[model samples]
Target: MEDLDTLVLRTALRWQATGLPVVLVTVARTWGSSPRPPGSLMAINGRGETVGSVSGGCIEDDLIHRIREGGVQAACATDTPAVLRYGISADEAHRFGLPCGGTVELVLEPVSSRSRLDELLQACLQRRSIERRLDLRTGQVELRDGRRDGVPRLDDTHLATCLGPQARLIVIGAGDLSRFLCQMALGLGFEVVVCDPREEHRASWELDGVVVSREMPDDLILRLRPDARTAVVALTHDPKLDDLALIDALQSDAFYVGAIGSRRNSAQRRERLHMHFDLPEAALQALHGPAGLYIGSKTPAEIALSIMAEVVAVKNGIRRPSPTPVVTGKSLHENPGYEVT
Candidate 1:
């Protein structure tokens, strides 16, 4: 499935192309305890149909009611843009189903030729990050190359936001674990690729909606040269397949690089990378050996869940305790007297 943001934008563009009125809503700012952060996007059509979300169901309901009661103009009121705020008071917060003290500010703009959503969507599909600056008064927009991520900026005259590329994943092998992991990643809006040079493995690789490659893992890594928005996971138990990819992935800008193995094998993998590959200690330190957050996962599906959880945690900048990793957790389970140092 497409990422929520992309789905919203694409649906909005489709509606607009079909001569339907559409309003693009963005969460410009938020106060304590908001569900959606700044830069979140949603789109509503003339018929009150919506894609994406700005808040919980209550906020969306309010927007839909406005459209149904007064048409698209109820939200935008004009061809330009409009600013809206919700949940300033306790009663208002409760009515809108917001957490106590939560508030959200939105910019609602009527989708028009000036909105340039088509160009924006094109950039997103191409995996290019673009900053869209919307003039609050004129509804004019400017698009430029942008960083992969940033908070939305709003001023008296302009709103500057980044429309970054979708997050990507490169799986270094194809197996039951890889299939489960790729499925989870796809649902989480990651563009997933599965690479396996082994002909036997490639012959049986039949997952849908994933890019399958027969190139060697290391070669694939070098070709893709994963960016900050990319993640690499080595699932093949074979050191020949997982190690080279791990080596190259650790040297790239990928936000997460991981390998699945037993605790002892994980240590050996690290040692091999450091010695035989002449990789730096710092680079090897970035690897997630026995990849996954510890959850006593024995089945392939459960292991995939743990690994995907760790990948997302790292992506969101959520730092878990050292004891949470699979290796550490298994160690503590096997040896209760063992301490985390």
Candidate 2:
């Protein structure tokens, strides 16, 4: 799935190329409690069609209404962007579905040839992070290579927004668990790729919007050169497939490198990597063995959910608690309602 900002830009580019007027709305600032964060984007065409979002639903509705009524066109007539505020008052907040005392400031830019929507879209498609600067007075735009996540920067004259690479997830397996994990990752806006050299698994694998690779795991990992925005998860549980790929992933810039396995197996794998491969202890420490958070998951779906949750937490720079054993009194078949005493 494309990231929200990228989707918004692509939609705007399409509308503009079709000779339709488009307006790009960005959540420039927010206070108290806002559904969308700063730099969130929404694009609306002259025909009231919209893509992406800056708020829940109310803000988009209001924007659509304004577009239909020519309010937005009139505001952009001078070829200068306008800043609009919503939910300033209690009634307004409630009416707009904003939390109490919440406020959202938006920058509405009338899209045109000079908006460079196409250039921005190209950069994003090429997986290049960029910094986009918009002049508040002249509606001009400037694009540059960006190294960090984009944040909205508003001063007296210009607003600078960061547009970063879409997060990528490479699952080193094509199985039931991989299917669930890929789906969840897609819903989370990750460009997912599943790699399995085995023909039987590859033949049976069927999931939309995911790229399936028959390339060997280590070679695929090397070619991908996983960055900070990338995550690699090995669910095959086969050492020959999982270990080599994991070694390459750990040595790369990937923010998360995890493998699904039992605690004992995880330890044995680490020992082998150290003894035979001579992988450094620090790199081994970076590997997430027995991957997911401890949730006592017994099924593939639940395990996938736990792993994705952990990956998200790490991506958000949240420190997770150390893994713990799932405490249960007895097997589910023996004690369906088993509880730890």
Candidate 3:
């Protein structure tokens, strides 16, 4: 339903009494490469207002144009669910600016109060995860049980998606890089938390929607218990603070624990954690020394972007092209001194 489609979709449905027409777009499939993944949702209002995205921009642009032509007016008759595809050839790919040889398919469904979309939205809001079994034959949806432990799962007939709530990012400093990283992470749907115990760092900090904490990094890491969906980045590089938090994080389930430093410094940090705290080689490897993809990122924002890419790749079961996988500290090779299976 529109509510399951985007947050804006729910707002549209809830505010329908205010009388505004809305259109919804969903990404159904892709081939070769695509900017947005399948299951992504976007919504547009009668006035060309938009929320979320399907393609990088081109598809959204095309959708916007269609809305202007009265594509999704509420007064229009309901449409049977339909599957739409884009970018079948090289020229089309270039026209849409899809990655070379890219193709994407989508499902567009119009919703009303009488539609089952409202039901689906309510079910989703009530549970950590829920499967809306769609009747392709009748378009009726049935709600089923789902899981919230670890990664959530959605095994539905029409689509399979696992949104484990929102990912959390805890940055242990309020420096320029942390600011950039916080913004980048927030855009990617991470609940960004910036922790700075120092007043100097907190005074000048001015990132929006980011949770600022004054607790010590180590204490905060333990409290947050960084889950598999969580990413922990230490930017201060101060062992007195960062090291303890890194130690605590290494023992938890955080998917990514990284420090911004040269590889050499990471090696030194490893030795210290290994000797002082007895952090095994396994845990140390998960400490992404030198963080970020090796994509030649130099600026604070770019570095933040690269690191986010790596974090996302790991989180989404996306295969990393690099030879060495970002170790999760639980891998066998990371444990030369001991064994954890």
Candidate 4:
């Protein structure tokens, strides 16, 4: 089985064939509060690299060092997974610019082989959540089921959830927020789709890999049936689109279901939902609104960034309890008329 980094490296090689340079970096492990979880990957090429990171630049520098000292070919062939440590340690952390030595282990691999990466990428495209096992004893790799973990022979968790090379995001609307949200979501590896029945908005829409549709949002929600890995963001202010999707989202188990609005708006939205939609206080309250953190974002792009950041946190399996307003800030005032008969 091929890992995400190897697949990225292979992609780099494919791009390189068309005259682009690509490098693959993987996070083999992390100490604390690391930017990316283990198995996180970033690919760089001859011109520029993916912006996120493979560890503090030391590991990147090591790869660059290898590139300079050894040829790119030599660097690429160091196929074995390598362990790196960062920390609460003092001097070691400073050297890598890690706050307190937060060690992040990296497994760097050069991409050129189409054989393994092609297979892995294929599985992801098939929407299969695969667990790829790397045999540390030997450099052999194998892909297995996430649930079964077929090859328990590995000493660690080598499973990286594959969104099939494109992370899938469903945004309801084609407005300014949707445009910004789609673009930002795409940058973060999500294959986004914007749904709106309005003809005027869909015509001018433009974003690569985003599907624009006039289908009813609720219908689309049922059809899409977002999986655990998928995220649904309700962008339109209309509860027709937003609430319907929210109902489906609440039931379907998508990782994140958020509405873009303010605190008061969120409250009213919840009240409307609880009254008519049959959604419980628990489910209606599950939504994040004023979505995004209290980032003080006034512009569309900043708002998009905040939303994307929250989505990533959700993707990383961070569990944020529904904001009770009370625990985190103030408990929301209960609504009286909304109670069911």
Candidate 5:
């Protein structure tokens, strides 16, 4: 499944291509508390159809009402883009269902040939990060190199935002745990690939959205050369398969490299990598052994949930503290008196 941002852009482009008057709305700024952050995208068509979201239902309803009432011109006001603000007053905040004192500013651009949304979407499809600079005065856009995870910048005359590759997950195994992990990752809009050289495991691997590969784990890792938006998780519990994949993933730019195992096994795997592979301390430290936030998971599905949660946390720049580690939870479970030092 495509990520939300990509879905919005693709749908908007389709709407425009069909000669529907579409307005692309971007959340350019926010204050106090907001449902979505800056760079959030939404598209509304002349028929009151919408894809994506800027705020909760209230803001989207307002946008739809405006478009349905005054065609596309209501959102943009003219050929140039328009800036609209909501929740500027206490009453307005309540009406808009924004948190108290919350406010959001949006840029509404009427979709047109000059928008160059097709090129922007193409760049994203090709996994190339590009910044889209919107000339608010002229409604023309410029594309340049940018980070996939960049912040949106709004200035007096322009709105600059980055769009890049979808986050991807490489699972180094094919089993029940990997099955659940792949399913969760697909639902979360990640492009998932499952690799396992074991024919018995590969023979049974059939998931709808994930790509299944029979390549050895290390070879798959090397071939993919995971980028910053990518994540790698080893789940086979076999040292030969998991260890090599972990080594390559840790050395790469993958934002998350992890393995699922017991605390003891996790330590053993790390030792094996460090002792035999000569992996640097930093890379070893980067590995998320016993991957996942400790959520008392026992079933395969629950385990996948925990691991995917940690992967998403790390991807979103959230670092859980010491108390949340699987080791901490397992230790406490194993010994009632165990306390984190």
Candidate 6:
């Protein structure tokens, strides 16, 4: 599934191409709590058809009603964007389904050729992070390259919003675990790709909305050139396939690089990476072995859930305590094959 921003932009562009009057609403600011973030987007056309959302149903309903009643048209008649605030009072909060003290401010821009929705969509599709500046007085827009995601910046004259590339997940296996992981990632708005060179594994694989690649893992990773928004997870458990891809991933900008294995296997994998591959200890430390949050997951689906949870936490820059149980070197020495399940 495409991210919400991409969906909103594509819908708006399609609506505009048909010569329909469309309005694009952006959540510019929020206070207390909000269902959507500051950069969230919503678009509505003259027929009251809508795509995307700025709030939990209530605000969208209100916007539709106002558009139908010409409230939005009156504001757009001057070809200038308008700022709308919701849930200012206790009663209004209740009506709009917001938390007691929650408030949200939106910038409503009438879609036009000057809005540059097409150009923005192109940039996003090309996987370029961009900053879009909207002039409050003239409704004109400017697009430029950006490196980070930021909350909407609104000043007296303009509102600048960041539009980043969609998050990507590269699962280095097309097994049962990969199927579950890919589906979950897709639901979480990740562009998923599964790579498996084994013909038997590739032949039986079947999943929608995911790209399946038969290329070598390391070659594929090099080609993908994973950015900070990308994640790499190896579920194959085969060192020949997982290790090389993980090495490439660790050398790249991928925010998450993990491999599924038992405790003993994870330790062995690390040693192999350091000794055979001559990878530095600091680089090897980035690999999440025995990947997942140690949730005692016994099923493939449960394991996938645990792995995705950790990936998301890292993506959000949240520091979490290691869930792996501590074991002494003497204990490992005594039981060479000891594994944590």
Pick the lDDT winner. 1
In order, candidate lDDTs are 0.88, 0.85, 0.68, 0.64, 0.87, 0.87
Q: What are the TM-scores, per candidate, against the unseen true structure?
A: 0.94, 0.92, 0.69, 0.70, 0.95, 0.92
lDDT of model 3 at position 272: 96
Error of 6 at 123 (Å): 1.2
Each model's RMSD to truth, in Å? 3.4, 3.7, 7.6, 6.4, 3.3, 3.2
The CA root-mean-square deviation of candidate 5, after full C-alpha superposition on the true structure, stands at: 3.3
Q: How accurate is candidate 6 locally (lDDT)?
A: 0.87
The total number of steric clashes, by the backbone 3 Å criterion, in model 4 comes to 20
Model 6 per-residue lDDT at 308: 95
Shift of residue 176 alpha carbon in model 4, Å? 1.6
Error of model 3, residue 332, in angstroms: 27
At residue 196, candidate 2 shows an lDDT of 98
Candidate rank order under TM-score: 5, 1, 6, 2, 4, 3
lDDT leaderboard ranking: 1, 5, 6, 2, 3, 4
Flag regions of model 4 displaced more than 4 Å: 1-25, 32-37, 42-53, 71-104, 108-115, 147-166, 261-265, 296-306, 321-341
lDDT of 6 by residue, 21-63 (tens): 8899999999998888899999999888899999999999988
lDDT of 1 by residue, 1-341 (tens): 68888999999999998999999999999999998999999999999999999998899999999999999889987888999999999999999999999999999999999999999999988888899999999999999999767889998889999997789999988888899999999999999999999999889888788999999999999999898889999988888989989989999999999988766778888999988999999898888876878776767888889889999998998644255433534652222111112
Candidate 3 per-residue lDDT over residues 51-135, each given as its tens digit: 8888889977877777777657432335444456789999989988899999988665554443455655665544335554444
Task: Provide backbone clash counts, one per model.
Answer: 0, 1, 2, 20, 0, 0
lDDT of 2 by residue, 1-341 (tens): 87777788888988888988888988899999999999899988888899998888998888888788884575466667988899999999999999889999999999987788888888877778889999999999999998646578987788899887888999999999899999999999999999999999999898989999999999999998998889999988788999989989989999999988766677788999999899999999988877877666777788888889899989988755455554464222111111112
Residue 111, candidate 1: C-alpha displacement in angstroms: 0.7
C-alpha lDDT of residue 229 in model 3: 61
